[model samples]
Target: MQAKAFDTHLFKRILKYTKPYKKRYYGVVMFAILLSVFAALRPYLLKQTVDDYIAPKDEHGLLLYISMMGIVLLLETLSQFYFVYWANWLGQDIIKDIRTKLFQHILSFRMKYFDHAPVGQLVTRSVSDIEQIARIFSQGLFMIISDILKMLVVLIFMFYMNWRLTWIVILAMPVLVYITRIFQRKMQVAFEEVRNQVANMNTFVQERVTGMKIVQLFNREAIEYEKFKDINQKHNKAWIKTILYNSIFFPIADIISSLTLGAVILYGGFHILDGDKFTTFGDLFSYTMFIGMLFNPLRQIADKFNEMQMGMIAANRVFDILDSDKDVQKDGTVIASHLKGNIRFENVVFSYNDKENVLKGINLKVNEGETIAIVGATGAGKSTIINLLNRFYEINSGAIYIDEQNINEFQMESLRQQIAIVLQDVFLFADTIHNNITLNNPNISREAVIEAAKKIGVHKFIKTLPGGYDYDVKERGVMLSSGQRQLIAFLRAYVNNPSILILDEATSSIDSYSEELIQKATEKITKNRTSIIIAHRLATIVNANKIIVMDKGQIVEEGTHQELLKREQGYYKNLYDSQFALES
Candidate 1:
């Protein structure tokens, strides 16, 4: 991709976040003005002390000048403190607001977006990139403004003191400005490289760490380490390139600043020795200080300009996500309450990617409070049916209805709230078991969670743990066994009292004893409720009210266990017999 230019439109959008804190922003600007005023007064007072008081041998006048100079310095120091404090405070508040907004936007995106986007890249944007934006407010824009004001005030005094010496000093400025412009362009490119490399490194590390198990299991530690080293080297080189640019540019600026000071002294010294009444030793002294002051802000402006460039680049990345239109379909206005659980899929066709259909023209129906079990091979589109019913992805064509009303007509949140799912890979947050089960929902009280856990038959297993329901699961439930995590998922779904429940390969990867317990729990939970079970093991769904056998995105058989078994050469019979023969 071509590098994004610094976008004024995006900058204006970022500035809107600071609107609520306009008073604080104004406070920073006011303090910056006061700081500049005080800074200018210091050298002017120093000149008066030397020329008017010390040269005249007036002790009282000298003392007054010294004291006033001290007072100006003190006020300058105070203004500096407030300027820094308030500017940083404003930056932090703006970034906090942006981070919250970015996160909320991310949450609204469809699963399809996440399927292709890297988790670490998103994390880096929300955390590190947002921080760069904060620096624009705190260390970049406001500070640059303060520096410019100070330089302008100093220049005014320089011209007033001795316009001839001021002209000599100003002659060297164009060279420095030319050099700074070139440096700014190069630094902008360097900073962009650094940010890109950082994102790449973050993505690699996050994926490897999350999949560390596979790395060690396959004994690929050395190979992975080498890959990480390569990424790290690229990151290091990108940073060094930035450092190299800074190292060359700042010294050139310093050299130009010194040359300007030299020119001021050369001209002022000639006029002083010529016994010109217009030029005095104090004028030369004040002019020297003012020359340094003029060039100092210019140098800082170059540095702060690079910082602003970085912030703009970061803002471009953040805005890309914010502006994305690939969010979940959430346009339905109907609020579905107490759905009777009647479901019908009519001529449904779907595809995760647009290239090929996963479920091709499927049609099925289940009455209220019936348990329907789906059995199919690995890629037979069994789970895709459940994904469609939950509206995780939009169907390419056809319609899904609940209670004789099209599912699309129901509001997304209301429809999802009425359905609960227990997936084969159970995920638990790093929190107490109780919080994990209730998911921090205040309405699901502790007593209700405990009662639900008991109904699902996972209550005794939870109580045996040291903290019972309060036990922390840690990370992705690493503290618990696979079966325990499954049980927790069951309790979580059970407490919601969903009108429709889905158990997708819920008993596939567990010990036989846990399987028996889960089966019993399943019997209780599936009773008098609409349930769909996706199972690979044919025996698990033998008692299902109606069994639907799928093959390659098409339903091949539909019947009870006995009815399907009686069919000669049927897909369900063949699948059941193969497993049964293996056991025999």
Candidate 2:
């Protein structure tokens, strides 16, 4: 999001999250190893059954050999089951832990991060990206280990049975390895391209759907379709390349194995005719089975290797978020219960990046129960002040104090709990109206919710709905008007009954009628609270105890509304005059 150069060290960072479940993870790996060992044993026993039990037809030998084979099969099945279950459980557990940590890390990032980053990308990283990495743990890594172990066991047994014959099979392995390596590299690049293209398609779909209304209004549906089609074609091409390489890879591996198997039968058949006891009829059958066995695992291992490489690319992205620097973190200490709601900013100089400061050296103080209104143009750092006050972003150079204590010294959660902000853009969850208002805060009683709604004049409107407070606010509150959503937001902020209240363009979206009611509600809510309001309309803050007009992050004017109107110069006068012109 910050366009921070891609750091390939993310995979190492991800391994740290597996620390908590290392014991279970190791148990799963051990299980998989045992499963592989047992899997190889079954084939070896087939050879033994043919040579010793079936051919000889000795009664005691037959019974004992059948029992041993049955036992081997039983153990293999049980071990395979546990291996799969444990590996899957370990993968799921690790992913849960990773997601929790990633969620917290994302929340702790500065708002500026969200400004530059797409919501769709973050969603993909949190959900799909982690899933891909988890697949690497459960299926990709597990298959890889099992395949290699099976190949090794088969080779070891084959050589012990007949070294000269084994050499032919072993010789083909190097060539097989070389071909597989080349195929894996090609597949990895192709799949990585496919994955990237899919992500682009995801972003496109998300943006287009969210902006569907705008697209239709401008008659750009055809254009959007074309854009999506182009991205889809790119994705299809990438997938085609991946499929083509993968299709060739397995067959090539099979052919190489076939050549080796032919050599084994030819060489071993001649040796048996030459009266070599080791190269019996049963031995020839086993040798052929072993050669065939190597092909599947070898090919599977190559496929898993390619899959794991794709997952590694995703893991790199997921871990990038997990290991990102915490732009905002909680202080270990808690806020005093008797916090007096006094706030002071001393020489705050802030910048999102190093190039230019958003907020220059500035100072301000608001005593307990004082009402301060901030007025200026859109980019006057008004919202930045609120963000800093909430400890959402740290200043580059400054000290901010809350209740006579440096704000940073108090626990961030405690400090934020003391403040309530009604933002210009309100977001309501897809839940019941009551749950939305209460927001899972244990302290927020049902009575408080009703009271807040009543005070904000949302009670009457909500009651008109089918279920009143129980009515669902559907996705993004699409079921409600902008004004209704604003009222709901106001009630939510007020339900907290915080020591400090911030109305950030709080009434900017409501109509005149709703604005009047909100103004009255704000007056009652602001009483006896440390209040900061950012207003565009001059009439909204005419009665404020003090109005601080900011221009380019600096306070250019400060006084009561009457005092600013008298001055008739600077940002406040210009804003007032512009609003006056618009109204008239």
Candidate 3:
């Protein structure tokens, strides 16, 4: 659906967030009513004081009336403070809830969604776009409603005191409203472009910053900066359109307001008679004040409408993410229990996108507690096998089962809890080594982590570090060596005690010393558990119980390491020769 600046459906949806804070929301509306009442009463009170007391030169209880006006001012001031405070207070909370929901929803999305999604765009939606929505509350919706109410009350008073001047003032209003309608249409389209540009800039900046090491290493800093400059230029250009609209509209609005005030003053000056109640000097003074109240808000409507438009545009983007139910992985009713290590892929076929098949029809099986090492070249569907086993992506055609039960029959969380995957590039949070291992799971204690580390033979090495497990790894475990980080990952896997373990080229890119530690850790973790190891390096899988050789997404051969090497021209034979030949 196309986005609109003032869509009632969309506006109502945004308002529903206030349901949890209905009391505060009602408080805002009540304060708005009080402000309008206070504002309208001001001119009426002044008119009475001028006509009855000041004009007639009466001194009785003049101080009391003055004090009453002062009290009204104080009450209005107090109401104003709460109005501003609660409105902003409410906005902060709404964003907090929205940000939490957005992040949580993003977390549950399948790996396929992340494969095509830009991290920066998601960040912008959660951060920048949501920030704009807050203005819808703090500066746009309630404030606009308050202004409209004040204008309505002022108009009622204007017609009551003098209908002639009231009629004259409203004559110019239709033109103002017409012009505002045009501005709204123009600004809505412009604000949408501005938001688009913002997302583009965010995506570009995020990618560049995250890959800054590559940028600097390749000496492409100047090139990247130029590209970013181009993006920023487009962003500035989009904003300039909105700025141009405001620059033209506000002045025209002001001119119309000035003309309305002028008309009221010219007519009121001619009819100011001392004794006539409607045409009295006091009535004339009240009419001028009434015009300011009425026209001032009318003047501000365009600007506030811009804020609402920006907010609605932002809401459209945010809701787009929240509404993408298609990307969320399907949930299952059954919880996995006492999972056995038996795994099978029956004629499984898969693809990231629909057109090209990444995994053609294939069948494979592994017995309970057996370790199967898959050896394949790049793009041979090595990692895809691991991904499908974990249900990261659903197979195009065929079923995967564990212990004779379909894997999809189990809840996603339950299924994953039984599996542990250690990737080639280990990712550790900017937290302590202990926190990264247990992932703050609460159930897994420090002693369990230590036991796991000791089982993996890294406990002594960890103790050598300044704070042992307490040492902050910083972002991505940059403070630790590749081998140390790998050891931490092995410790994590050991602690999980998963029914199935998959190591996807885990030691391929690491230092030899780290590779040695990982090999030892692998031996400890794989015992008495099903393990699937995907490796490019042939020497690492020589001792596997069985070996599966893949070529072009199809399994070509399956046997023990020595049996595969015995074939005259087998895919595994060639791969093993080339890999070990280089090592020799």
Best by lDDT: 1
**All candidates in order of TM-score, best leading:** 1, 3, 2
Sort by lDDT, best first.
Answer: 1, 3, 2
Q: What is the C-alpha RMSD of each candidate to the true structure, in Å?
A: 1.4, 3.1, 1.7
Q: How many angstroms is residue 347 displaced in model 1 relative to the true structure, after the best TM-score fit?
A: 1.5
Error of 3 at 210 (Å): 0.6
Tens-digit per-residue lDDT, 240-348, candidate 2 = 9988987888788888888888888898889888988877777777777787777778777778876677667777777666666764465648665556789898999
Off by over 4 Å in 3: 273-277
Per-model CA lDDT versus the true structure = 0.89, 0.81, 0.87
Between prediction 2 and prediction 3, the one with superior TM-score is 3
Instruction: Give per-residue CA lDDT, model 3, range 164-201, as digits (tens).
Output: 87898889899889888888889889988988899999
Once fitted onto the true fold, the runs of candidate 2 whose alpha carbons sit more than 4 angstroms away are 1-19, 56-64, 326-338, 568-571
Better TM-score candidate (1, 3): 1
C-alpha TM-score for every candidate: 0.97, 0.92, 0.96
Give the better candidate number (1 or 3) by lDDT: 1
- The global Cα lDDT (0 to 1) of model 3 is 0.87
Best by TM-score: 1
